[model samples]
Target: MTVTELLDRAHALGSDPRNTNFAGGNASAKGVERDPVTGGDVELMWVKGSGGDLGTLTAEGLAVLRLDRLRAMADTYPGVEREDEMVAAFDFCLHGKGGAAPSIDTAMHGLVDAVHVDHLHPDSGIAIATAQDGPELTARIFGDRVLWVSWRRPGFQLGLDIAALKEANPQAIGCVLGGHGITAWGETSQECQANSLEIIRTAARYIEEHGRPEPFGPVIHEPLDEVARRERAAALFPLVRGLCSTDVRQVGHYTDSPEVLDFLSRAEHPRLAALGTSCPDHFLRTKVAPLVVDLPPEASLEEVTERLRVLHAAYREEYAAYYARHAVESSPAMRGADPAIVLVPGVGMFSFGKDKQTARVAGEFYVNAINVMRGAEAVSVYAPIPESEKFRIEYWELEEAKLRRLPRPKPLAGRVALVTGGGSGIGAATARRLAAEGACVVVADRDLGSAEKVAAELGARAHRPSDVAVAAAVDVTSEEQVVAAVRQAVLAFGGLDLVVNNAGLSLSRALLETTVDDWNLQHDVMARGSFLVSREAARVLLAQDLGGDIVYISSKNAVFAGPNNVAYGAAKADQAHQVRLLAAELGAHGIRVNGVNPDGVVRGSGIFASGWGANRAAVYGVEEEKLGEFYAQRTLLKREVLPEHIAAAVFALTGGDLSLTTGLHIPVDAGVAAAFLR
Candidate 1:
């Protein structure tokens, strides 16, 4: 391949949806065999190896190596990466060897003998391959130009397929491996790279042109009743496990995808089976369609079972046909029992895989695909790849193997979090930090402007103005308001996974001067509000069956009682107790509850300032400035505790990053909570 061709391929691969987010695929090319300086075959194949993002591949990422040696090593080792390592370790193969380890596809590339080879995981390609008609579509587009191999676990089989294809069409430009990705090889590295890019780019464009339209109707609905929910989950789990023969994650990744949300939210879910999975590779993990169990309220167990049997039979037939059309041979080894479609009574659909991870991936794919199909149906009629075509690619041995490989940076992605009082100060800061770390944040505050501002700054999708104190205003003190807020959050973002209850109020007064009204007023906002919110949050968290995190915003006064601020201190102390009680209650449900006792956060302005200011002056007979200075001086760091610092403490607790730290209070007062001397 020429340099120009290589550049073009790189650009096209980056643009292609099939290769979208390709973080660890490779591309390479080689010349005809020639005499080496040492009088041996000196054929050089340029291959992309580890740590290369196909979306942004450059010439430097491609490594040049001896094709014969690479192929020979593949014969010894079952996979390309292992073979490449063997060659790298030997001095005899050091002539054109780069220091970098070759891609897992290096051995496959050598076997193909094509001058150029390119591989990528384009979003569009995955979309097409994931369709029910993936095999037929593949044939329709590439036909004889590209060989469509059944999904196979990558490594030895991949190399074998390339070797077979090369023998049949010695000059074939490239081959599209169902489910996994595509590989292209030409007379030169550049040509092969260009061909590979063109294949995926063209495939992606074709998919986009024929892709499903936007969904036309509402997607979310009120959750099922407790009895119904438990029954549905229990019934669906076994059915899904049987179908995919994998441990199901029960709750799939669809909760995060917009398309899934739309599809699941629809009043009447139609053409669900045709949606397939999100990506072709996911098929090995999750079967094509989730079982839809739309049981009427009056339906009996027998009726539900009959309906499930009918659906199961239909699914099996479709799966068989899909495989027959796409599979090269009728006797291909099956991964497990015939894939089963889980029937989720009243709840929606889910795909099954061999493990929880795979099930979740497949479920996510199906949800997105369904949404897309619904959208397209709205625009016109949805026409996803037929079941037969999808089956072939999904069951392809090589593609199924790719499902075993996992992605990096787990733990935080797609998780939902709510940050109360998040419009400004510590709440706002915590929201931003959680968002940056991958959790979807719901910013709630009494000030709509403040809430919206934080949401806008963080680019969060959920923002609501909620007063956390008043049973009527914030209603954090009211079970009704608290329930409503939580429900709204879940409805808006799909689920509630984290909660940062950083909303409260404080008042200062000398014990002798403090009235009964003052004590009640302070207690109402801080103590009562915290209790109400925590109680409501616990209920919702338990219902979701998604273990959650709660971090209450207590003050150091809860521990180190401040002078003349008896009311505020008393309320804070109660708040701390609430955290412990909530934690103890919710622990069985996997919900972790904790508290942050910030001594003095100088950065939170407005009501916080007034409350703290009033207390500081009244207690110490000092100005606000002097009190702040004194507080700072008392800290080991001698630094003012900014709202951000306090927010950070809250974030750590609620993030689940500190899983075992529930019922504990972290002081973010710049060490003032620890210092005894004033």
Candidate 2:
């Protein structure tokens, strides 16, 4: 089969989460290609390369190696002790320029005698693979056709072992790699795929047939209803995330999926979860084991939080000990003492990583682990690879090398942001800019549809395009709505780090013409709105104990004394001073509060466009359309400020460059000398 068909096959297998976790599987095909050097045909193998997900495999992600050279190198094999060197040797076996770095699994697919090969970590197959009696169980389930290969760390030696087993068991279509996953081979890509599916299906059926009821024991703690479970998760995430981030900042993901809730509520959860995940892929992402905190479903938030604080510290100490116990001089420095996965019996799972996609995927992998443990316990006692071996894999030099290959993090990589009024104007611009710098963004606005559109666009540009941004609806004036919006941000990406209070409304009226309703509406939307948003977010920020940011999109009228703008100007002045007041009160907590005063954010501003533009233009004796130019010409710099300009100023206020500069106001009015802070 052609290499194109191989990629199609790889995508099919990876697309099914049942077959593998994210980036977990590898596939290959042996084929003939024309050699430019000899002007003749040569044998080559195309396999999925390092750091590539099978679901999204592309031509560029395939490593092409010459079979003759790869086979020849086997003769000089330095055995298992120097198997790491064999990974480097694959570089030499590369054909021509080589498409991508060959993964360690390259040997497993390459050395096999079959023309087509697949090495997958399907949940059902891994359930049997990691079972206590995996070898005997394999014989019972698939009989002799599925050979059982004992556990061996993945390397060139393991590849050779599989190849030797295949040669001896001539009739076997595939093998179950003990304490790991599954592998299958065939003469064609379709046949290989079929054999892989058959093994997975048969193993799954066998487990179902022979499994006992209540494999995890009866549920001792039933999950809370959906809303209450989410509320508990939301309440606990920031504190837990903060604990995880003591050494390094982390992005978090929360999931209350049925499988997760089911697993957490079972009686055997603590025992099985503590035993840890079996597959290296799952273990690598989830760490050695999860941190489980069990409390009654009706427990008070205060009690639950207090319990978490105690447990979190113990978890860190234990994790540090785990690192100390197994580390060698050559092992990579301990990555962190933080647990990747945290389980609350009534809630669901909270997973942490360096970014949103990583965090989300990490949690998803643990769900796969849960499934693995359940399946294994159904028929056989759950048995993972030993702790020492897990330590070796966790700190492997090769994995460290892969990590080093990643680009350095962006300035706001792990920070979370909530941009109010993000559907349009400065808020939207700020959301885009922050997301571009790697912050997880919550685009919140009164217009749900508009917010959703912005979030969709933001996610498309993100590294993994999954959880980088989300939309939330908020009127800001309503305390309930504001709190919910902030909670949405916390539930989405752990907790808050940046908040832009930009939602506002205005009406330009002379003192005599303005009604109290006009005054109250403007004040309620801008002044009271900013206060509620700030107050609710502050709860999470204080809980995190990590420094955070609060930016107010105040107006130049706060200091400019603009005409026929009494209500609007008064509200702006209130917002501007709130920045100073909050900064002073919160400085000890490291919560920096700042304001941006823009005179002419007229072009794209929602406040300006909704009739406020025409009234203000009338007051100044200029046409509404030319108001931006009029305002610009009035400025000392004679420049027109756009939404992007305001966004940049917002970024400057909290974007590390001005970390120590709080209780400050930066104008984005293209140099409005009259609106100087002093």
Each model's lDDT: 0.59, 0.90
Top-TM-score candidate index: 2
Worst 10 residues of 1 by lDDT: 463-472
Q: How do the predictions measure up, each by TM-score? A: 0.60, 0.98
Task: Tell how far residue 621 is off in model 2, in angstroms.
Answer: 2.6
lDDT of 2 by residue, 1-678 (tens): 478889999989999998887889899999999999999999999999998898989889999999998888789998789889888888988997849899989999999999999999988999999999998899999989999998888989999999999999989999999888999999988999999899989988988899987889998878899888888888899999999898899999999999998988888999998898878898889898998886777788999899888888998899889899998788888888888999988888999999988899999999988888889999999999999989888898988888898999999999999999999988899999999888999999999999999899999855465588999999988999999999899999999999999998889899999999999999999999999999999999999989899999998989989788899999999999999999999999999999999877888888888999999889889999999999889888898989999889888887799889899988878777778878
Candidate 1 total steric clashes: 45
Every candidate's CA RMSD: 9.6, 1.5
What is the Cα-based lDDT of residue 23 in candidate 2?
88
Give the C-alpha miss distance for residue 294 in model 1, angstroms: 5.3
